[model samples]
Target chain A: EPEVTQTPSHQVTQMGQEVILRCVPISNHLYFYWYRQILGQKVEFLVSFYNNEISEKSEIFDDQFSVERPDGSNFTLKIRSTKLEDSAMYFCASSEEGLGNQPQHFGDGTRLSIL
Target chain B: AQTVTQSQPEMSVQEAETVTLSCTYDTSESDYYLFWYKQPPSRQMILVIRQEAYKQQNATENRFSVNFQKAAKSFSLKISDSQLGDAAMYFCAYSPNSGNTPLVFGKGTRLSVIA
Candidate 1:
């Protein structure tokens, strides 16, 4: 089965620096999403994109966070200024459709660490 | 707002036995979806099973099954004939029927399968 793929499985960035996490969602999937899981914590939703625009976002998704589908399969999450609290495993997901019954497939996740 | 809760922080089961992970959620929406995701040590989020609120029958995938009680707002995952690979962080997630809404996840239950 096709799976969502993320690059730079581990990322270490200095606080206040910009970092971009890249993901290549399954080829035929349309809906895209970003989520984060701090160590030993629940996974938290960040943002969802469809039709080339953000459909919904969580409060955790602040102004410093932005997502873009630069091309057909490349969906990127960019953090303008990283903070220590931003250190977590970031996961990207995609689904063939946004229907409730359709499952969202997730990537292996990118582990981001801020100094 | 929707919130999912996994009361059991951790659980253990012997290989070839069965184990159940508990999950509950608070949701006002009548139409929604529930999911169980397994995150192994590699931190890859793998979809285990899914249930639709409208469906009365529980969903089953191989050794994985769900006991969904809509009235009680409970969705639990049961892994029968457990293997070492079943050891992972199990997350319960919820989402409204709307396509724009993102998934709300619980704190997750860490399952350890002993050989």
Candidate 2:
């Protein structure tokens, strides 16, 4: 089975530094998403991308966060300025398009640890 | 807003036994999809099972099955013949029936299978 792939499985950065997480979604998938989970907390949606544009985003997806589909298969999330609270597991997911309702296949996730 | 809830924080079952994990969601939309994802110690999010809200017939895959109740907005996972390999953090997720939306996940239940 084809799986989403994320680079830099684990990353440690300073609180004020910038970080970028990358993902390569399944080749035929049309929708991409980013979500984060703080330790022992729920996984929260950050943003959704389709047609090379952001379709929707949650409140947690503030100014510092951005997503891009720079190429056909590569989707990426960039944090302009990281905070200590930003430490969490960041997951990238993809699904074949129609609405936002299809089953999404997820990546292994990048453990972002901010010091 | 839609929200997914998994009331059980932790559960344990002896090897070769059976276990059930409960999940509920609040959504006004009738068409959507529900899923159970497993996060192993390696923190890789793996898709275990999925159910369509409009399908009365539940979904089953190998030892994994789902009891999906559309009226009650409840979707529960049943794992029979559980093994130590089943130990993981299980998250119940809700997604819209359309194509571009992101998945909403519960806080997750940690399942431990004892030998």
Candidate 3:
């Protein structure tokens, strides 16, 4: 019953500052993803990574956002410039294989608040 | 682009009762996966159930089951003999291409189980 784990369950950052959200995906997973849910809004896709590179990303994942598997187990999302609209609960997920039947398991989200 | 919609913003059911949360999606791709994720007060996204578009039979897992209508582009979750723990925000999601792609989620429905 391994699970994805995220660091700093709550993060408060000043506007225009850089913030990194870290996550340790399940050990054997091959695909990783980042999603965020703004209060009262739907969960939005940010980015997906595999083979040590970004496989796909949403429009929300613009130039300001970047993801890296800096190490074997850690996947990090970095926001170069934070804004009030960037505040949300960020979730990390991983899947053994990115197949239609293989579902992704998510970590307890990191609540990010940009001032 | 694919979009998942959860029409009901909130639903309530008495303990030991049954409740069904509706979900519909708009996708042109013939092969895709549908999922239901439950988020409790802790804000952890937990996978509840899943369905493959190619499967003609509906998918069921313990007390959780899905009524999937591929033609109608509908995937609904039914919680039988609901318990208090079933109270959470339910999000219906869609994943296309069966590759390292991101999940598209619905706005989510808040389920409240009364004791």
Better of 2 and 3 by lDDT: 3
For all candidates listed, what's the TM-score of chain B alone? 0.98, 0.98, 0.98
For candidate 3, give the lDDT of residue A60. Answer: 94
Candidate 3: where is the Cα deviation over 4 Å?
Answer: none
DockQ of candidate 1 (2 decimals): 0.79
User: Compared with the true structure, what per-residue lDDT tens digits does model 2 show for residues B11-36?
Assistant: 99999999999999999998888899
TM-score of chain B for predicted candidate 2: 0.98
Query: Of all true interface contacts, what fraction is found in model 1?
Result: 0.78
Q: Model 3: per-residue lDDT, tens digit, A1-115?
A: 8989999899999999999999999999999999998999999989989999999898899999999998798999999999999999999999999876688999999999999
List clashing residue pairs in candidate 3.
none
Ranking 1 against 2 by lDDT, winner: 1
Q: After superposition, how far is residue B112 of candidate 2 from its true place, in Å?
A: 0.5
Instruction: Rate residue B87 of model 3 by lDDT.
Output: 93
| Shift of residue B28 alpha carbon in model 3, Å | 0.9
